[model samples]
Target: MNYIQKGLLFRLPENNKDFSITTFLDGLKDSLSATLTHFHPLAARLVTLKQQKPPSLTVFLNPENSPGARFIHSVVNLTVADILTPTDVPSVVHESFFDLNKAVNYDGHELPLLSIKVTELIDGIFVGCSMNHMVADGTSFWHFFNSWSEMFKSRSFNISRPPILDRWILAGSDQIITLPFTHENQYINRPDHPMLRERIFHFSSESLSKLKTKANSECNTTKISTLQSLSALVWRCVTRARRIPADGNTSCSLSVSNRSRISPPISENYLGNMVQRLKATTTAGELLDHGVGWAALQLHELVVSHNDKAIKKLMDVWVKGSLLVNTSVHFDRNGVHIGSSPRFDMYGNEFGLGKALAVLSGYANKFDGKVMSYPGREGGGSIDLEVCLLPENMAAFEADEEFMSIVNV
Candidate 1:
């Protein structure tokens, strides 16, 4: 199980006076209980199999073995308007929005794999979620959310396809084992920058189209995608903003989902970490000398290179404990990690009160060079980026001439 942590924050509008906090709390609690009834693995725990020959851990989903998901309710003094505004770009709301430390910093065994916190503000309510990456990936997590919301609104979980919880659908060598909770050497420490901050950047479809054209023109090829174009542009801006040395090695990595790429294709509903990181590396000078199109082509080629054979090889390396998954590794301000998908149904969580005012992330995303995207607030083909970087670099990035030319204000 990969011990990575992920979170989501949903903002609900002001409640009617008749709908008291107690009423809302009761609804949330009951809905969660109903949700667990279907997704029992979420309410379970990862117990160590001390006596097993392979020294493994398994998920125990019974009432006696699992204590259920953690639920928290609280009220904040801030109003929705104060935090959810254009001026609040690099939003500082995640830390105050939810307690991430309790989830990510847990000792895997003693804590619930899933936890939800409901914070009531002066004008609205926010729901923050923290789930262990070992148990669920983004798709599985959102699938659970869709089910929960369905149960909340329709009073039942009648979704067409339910989650398939078999961890080893593709049987491998006996020595191939799941990454354990004790193998905490996966993450690499970042620089001790005291003023790291996060900001949201919006790129309209038109803006993205213009960027795509510009990138293609630079490469003299029409092979790059909107995602590759945007990623290359951001990578350039961040590298330049940090003023890294010419010879310094700079890298950009994108998290690629392998569910569809595997040999026979893994079911979309099959729950596990079915994702890999695809990275492109270059020296600061090389990247700076090239146009956005050139950088985009590099990323495009990197993504295209991960064929079926490559994926299988990567999987083999993973099982052998030889895969150097440096997704969390920050290399001297020279690396940027891009994740999340614009295709994710972020704004669709209606929960019976209309769509969410704004969907957001938690403190886990506050690291430098972390970029995540979802559909824009106005919908359509627009993209909204939740970008995190050092405060100084962020200022330079926000003001970059080329970036400003295409970035939506």
Candidate 2:
């Protein structure tokens, strides 16, 4: 688990005469403090108990000693168009987030588990949040965000979905297991990476419908979902754009939610990571030659087979080894890792300024072939894919006819 960073852009209030940065910050701080009362783990710290027999790791929350989440307020000399109108995301957008791109989840021991930076633009506001992945997955992260916004808007602490704080451990699995590493520094290593290009490809409802229909018709099945079809399309396009050898292997790893996959099913509001990464591998030739339908079906089967039994089995193996997730080691440059989700309510996080103009990601976990999906701002079934690739590959991918034919532009 690494840091999950996202930025939400909002236009300044129309009645700007009354808008004061001091008032806004006071409201935001107040709401966030109230929100953290329910989601207390965000204010907590990770403690490595090396003296214990197993040398366990724990999330310790001490109300007296806990340093609260970090809040930063910054003023930038930019406008809404500076971010929303660009096909390529501006490099300055990354500055909206806290400079914790190099920090992994274990850094929570000394650092804040959650940090929010409010950037006041010339005509808009960008609220960026960096949350330790060990504290929550996308669902839980959004849950907290939505709650905070709800409280801010309503001026009350009541939220529709209160988080379930009880941690879920497998029935037979050990509650405490030793981590493979003794120190957090072992996880921090800087590696030279290619100059990557990040772009958000918008696919309207009509285009997504066409893609889903084409994929289902080709496969002669309705089991493939819109997300699976979209993912398959990007995988194929990226593989071709990269000019990987036909015999070369490529894989698509999807971050799957395990809330429903568990036996009794965990609540949607569970406040922890209930997600797992599942990968489907195939040669470039096989994936491209068979078309998007074949690729989608492969993903469909992969997701269908990850049932409760499979989840438990994987957890058993993980508990035995206790291997912490390292992004550099786990991610493959040639393969695509689809993260975030279109299901998250990105556009609905309206504080007092109304709906967000757009959503952006931070620099953490960014590498070639990293794809973050968000529900389109217009709602409906449309999707916005924030894709990161090597500069040359991105150029080729944008020029690929088959891939561009379906883009909404």
Candidate 3:
């Protein structure tokens, strides 16, 4: 049986002067084996007993095909750094940044869809997580993290039982449901490379709170939550920052955790992709005018609208059968990002070594940029946003007067 799970990659700068490939793998293997056992005993047994399948594994085992137990598929990416002093956290931890200058081309079929090439650079590190959009959504990624951490630390991992759906069950449903795959002129060739940008922004708790308040007050609306506000703010900021025209074609796409939002939340903690995109757009002036709060309401509606039965039917039809193969509709738009709550507090990313000093991540193809909403520094009131963007765009943003006024554009 051949199966491939997209790999998520990250770069960790060399912290101390020492690192051992063999020793690190040793700890990771036992840890991953333990986690698989704890999380899905059956799957773990299949693996341990030489049953469950991994792409790295052949139907028949060869010496090289043996399962490498580490949940983390890792490697070392080396680069030249600017200096040779004792590395600090940012220097060591963020060395991923330096290696990012390398080329990435996911133009053809490949497995472990995501990968991290960690390099020791002259100035810093280059970090990224390249994965197939199918293997795991944000939530599943964290599940793997939590489980991996528990196993590595040799601690009891108490995981909230994830709802399990046998693939056969979904297959049965297909017999009764037909999805709309072909419409008149339905398939438009996806752009060769949409103008997707990568950016990361940082905000102190105070800035986030004030921004939320400003969004609410300006829109004359009260229902705007922090996420809604922030998303809208980012939309506006990027539009203005990138000098995208007011009438430029764009969409603000984000995720709705079907966990609590749906009638019978689909699955509590499944290790697979379970998410829908909420893509909404507005004229630049309208976006800037209603500001974050109003745009947030628009966002709310886009998602709620999908809750109807017809939409579900459409999805069942659209995603049915072998009609669809691996697809990553990577967009090249100037100002869109997959924004999310980093959910760091949940990932017990501890190895036998220690708590991870920092987590550096990026995505595949042209998803423009990415934004992660994380807990604030003090653990209360404040919110922290880690934004990843092109250095030049960032420079333009820092210097733009109108843009600075929004944040102070």
Candidate 4:
């Protein structure tokens, strides 16, 4: 094998030979990035030294003592050619565990960079690889991707610097990070998704504007951004659409961007894991406190606050794992799980292939789904979103008027 003169290559081990597929995928995620598709090998940029050595287990608290640790995952070398796209050939179908197929989700011909295509090459047992945005943000991923191809095809190539995670989030000074979210403990029951799921939805700018208009009229609040209003409206609609008991309350999530909000302002952009939730409470009391507009306003305030102290407070507590954000949807006992935006834009990503036609994350019918909404190039006024929710909710949503107004669906 050729040496990656400048970049790094690491390896790790799986302590338990019986590591389940889920465990293997999750473990790979800690190391691999969702933006792996954007990166490639580079003799010069590559660090010839292995990244995982001794194949040992490594662990750390998530600042909140949130069972955070690193594990080693091993895989065999493999290659594929028939799998390449007509427009472009996939450099390596199995370059790493980050490329596993079973781990990825998408609705079209393109790939969800966040997923890895794990192939069971040998037996019912499988070796894994993955692709997650944070493993390599779009910018960094592309840099590495191009670099590798450049290295193999050319004599040498210069690679860009890797993305940093140090300042991704700065917890709120006033923020509290206590476990077993007592406040929302009851709403935290995990919904079972026995089957794997995938889904996609597209909206035009005009339709999105219509939805915004409806939200503005219904909530009597102009302070809301499209996302805030949309998220709020969606939460309510999803709950109603799915026939979920509204009396129990619900939580809609919105991931906040801390680009220039932090002290250091994580300036480098590649594949951003620089995302955290801005959860909205949908309980009647919460609605009364903020006038039912709580959800939409919560998002609007977070995005526009721009207060140094407020931003600092958020980041500080998050680092310490004491960031307390309770949403009505996650209002169950012990805190239900909810994830948001796998924020993709890094260094104005424009894959000579043209900005991705669409981007999304999360598994369908798997609890509340994760979403990613980014501006489309060529002046598509509508914001694009990707989601995964219960099938019943999805069907009901498709049949609702408010839902239609939210996205003009």
Error of 4 at 275 (Å): 2.5
> 243-301, model 3: which lDDT tens digit per residue?
66767666677765555554555564655556665678677767765546677677766
TM-score against truth, every candidate: 0.88, 0.96, 0.65, 0.51
Write down the lDDT of every candidate, Cα atoms only: 0.72, 0.87, 0.46, 0.39
Instruction: Estimate candidate 1's alpha-carbon lDDT, on a 0 to 1 scale.
Output: 0.72
Off by over 4 Å in 4: 1-129, 132-193, 213-222, 268-272, 284-295, 305-307, 314-366, 374-379, 405-409
How many steric clashes between backbone atoms does each model show? 2, 0, 46, 79
Which candidate, 1 or 4, has the higher TM-score? Answer: 1
- Number of the top-ranking candidate, with TM-score as the measure: 2
What's the TM for model 1? 0.88
Query: For model 1, which pairs clash?
Result: 90-198, 90-199
Query: Which segments of model 2 are wrong by more than 4 Å?
Result: 52-64, 186-193
Looking at model 2, residue 328 earns an lDDT score of 75
Q: Where does model 3 exceed 4 Å of error?
A: 1-24, 38-132, 155-172, 175-199, 308-311, 320-335, 344-347, 352-355, 369-372, 375-378, 381-393, 400-409
Summing lDDT over every window of 10 consecutive residues in candidate 2, give the lowest-scoring window: 53-62
RMSD of each: 3.5, 1.7, 8.4, 13.7
